[model samples]
Target: MTLKVGTILEGTVVNITNFGAFVDVEGKTGLVHISEVADTYVKDIRQHLKEKDKVKVKIIAIDEQGKISLSIRQAMPKSSRPVEIDWQGERNKNSGLSFEERLAKFLKESEERIQDLKHREGRRYGTASRR
Candidate 1:
C-alpha cells in the first residue's frame, strides 16, 4: 500500500524507546513519537505501548529522508475521542446572559482569584520572615 500523509494504517510495535516507538506497517517502519502516542500526556512510552502490540497509526509526515512520522492519537476514530467542552457556550446556555455580563463576571472572578493568591503569598512570606 502507498503510504501517504493522513493515511491510517494498522501496524505492529516492533520496538519501544524512551523517546518513541518503532512500528512496522506494510513492511515499512515508522516512528510514533511519545507525544503522538495518546491524547493525554505520556510520561512513559511503555505505559501506552509494548513490543508486538497492534496499533492504528495515522501518517502525519514523511520527511525528505523517507522517514515516516506516525500518530496513534490521530488514528483513533472521532466517535471514541473526547468531546471538547466550550466553557463560554456552556455558561451562557444556563445563565442566558449577554456577552457584556459574562465579561464582567469573568473579570470579577479573576480579580478575586488574584487577590486570594496575593493573600496566600503574603501569609507565606510573613511566616517565613519570623524564622
Candidate 2:
C-alpha cells in the first residue's frame, strides 16, 4: 500500500522507547511520537502502548530522508473524540440578563473569590505580622 500523509493503517508496535513507539505498518516501520500516542498528556508511552500491540495510526509526516511520523490519536474516528465545550453557547444560555447585570454579577463573584483566598491565606500563616 502507498503510505502517504493522512493515510490511516493498522500496525503492530514493534518497539517502545522513552520518546516514542515504532509501529510496523505493512512491513514499513514508522515512529509514533509520545505526543501522538494519545489526545491527552502522556507522561509515559508504555502506559498506552506495548510491544506487539495492534494500533491504528495516521501517517502525519514523511521527511525527505524517508522517516515516517505517525499518530495513533489522529487515526481515531471523529465521533470517538472528546466533545468540545461551547463557551459562547453557555454565555448565550443566560442571554436574558443585561450587560450591566452581567458586569455586576462578575464583580460580585470576583470579590467573593478574593475574600475567600485572603481568608485561607490568613488561616494558614496567621494574621500576625513580624516587624
Candidate 3:
C-alpha cells in the first residue's frame, strides 16, 4: 500500500539509531526522528523503542525523493498529549485593560520572569550572568 501524509499506520521497527528509528510500513521504510518518537524528552531512543517492535505511527511527511517522515507522538490519542500553555490566549483574556496598563503589566511580568530565571541559574552555577 502507498503511504500518504497524515495517514496513521502500523509499522515494525526495523532499526534503531541514536538519532531515530527506522520503521517498515508495507515494504516502505520511514524514519521516526527522535523528537517525533514521543511528546516528552527522549534521552535515548532505545529507552522508548526497540527493534522488531510494532508501533503505530502517523505519516507526517513525504519528500519528492520518496523519503517518509513518521511521528509516533502524533499517532497517540489527543487526550494523552501534553497540555500546552496558551500564553497568547491568557494575554488576550485581559484585553479589556488599557494599552498603557497592559504594557506596564507585561513589563512587570517580564522582569519577574527574568529575575526568576537568574535566580535559578545562580543556584545551578556560581553566579547568574546577565543576559
Candidate 4:
C-alpha cells in the first residue's frame, strides 16, 4: 500500500545501517532517518532500534525518487506530558503584575543583556573593540 504524509503505519524494522533503518509497512517500505527516530540525542541507532522491531512510523515525506521519509518520533508515545500548567508561572495580567510593571521588567532585562554584551566585549578586546 502507498503511504502518504501524516499517515501513521505499523512497520517492521527490516534492516539497520549507520544512517537510518528500513521499515516494512505491510507491502510498502519506508525509511526512518536516524534523526527522526527519537526526540533526544541518539549517538547510535542500534541502541534505540533493532531488526524485526515493530515500530509505528508517520510518513513525513515522499520524494520524487519514491523515498518514504518516516518519523518514529511523532509515532511514539510521549512518556511525560505536562498535564496542568501552573498559571502562576504565566507572565500575563493574571500573574498580578500590572502591564506597566511587566514593561519595566522587560526593559530591565533588556538593559541587563545589553550590559552583559558590553562587558563581554570589554573583556575580549580590552575595551578598544568599540572603536
Put down candidate 2 lDDT per residue, 40-116, tens digits, no spaces: 99999999999999999999999999999999999999888999888999799769899999889889999999999
Where does candidate 1 stray beyond 4 Å?
A: 86-131
Q: After superposition on all CA atoms, how large is the RMSD of candidate 3? A: 6.8
Global lDDT scores for all candidate models: 0.93, 0.93, 0.95, 0.86
Per-residue CA lDDT of candidate 3, range 1-131, in tens?
76889999999999999999999999999999999999899999999998999999999999999999999999999989978788999878888999999999999999999999989989799786778
Instruction: Evaluate model 2: give its TM-score.
Output: 0.74
Off by over 4 Å in 4: 78-89, 93-100, 103-131
Per-model TM against the reference: 0.69, 0.74, 0.68, 0.65
Worst 10 residues of 3 by lDDT: 122-131
On residues 20-116, what C-alpha lDDT tens digit does candidate 1 reach at each position?
Answer: 9999999999999999999899999998999999999999999999999999999999988999788988766748778788899889999999988
Point out the higher-scoring one by TM-score: 1 or 3.
1
Output the worst ten-in-a-row residue range by lDDT, candidate 1: 122-131
- Clash list (residue pairs), candidate 3: none
Supply the global lDDT for candidate 2: 0.93
Give the lDDT of residue 45 in candidate 1. Answer: 96
User: Candidate 1: lDDT over CA atoms?
Assistant: 0.93
Candidate with more favorable, higher lDDT: 1 or 4: 1
Candidate with more favorable, higher TM-score: 1 or 4: 1
Candidate with maximal lDDT: 3
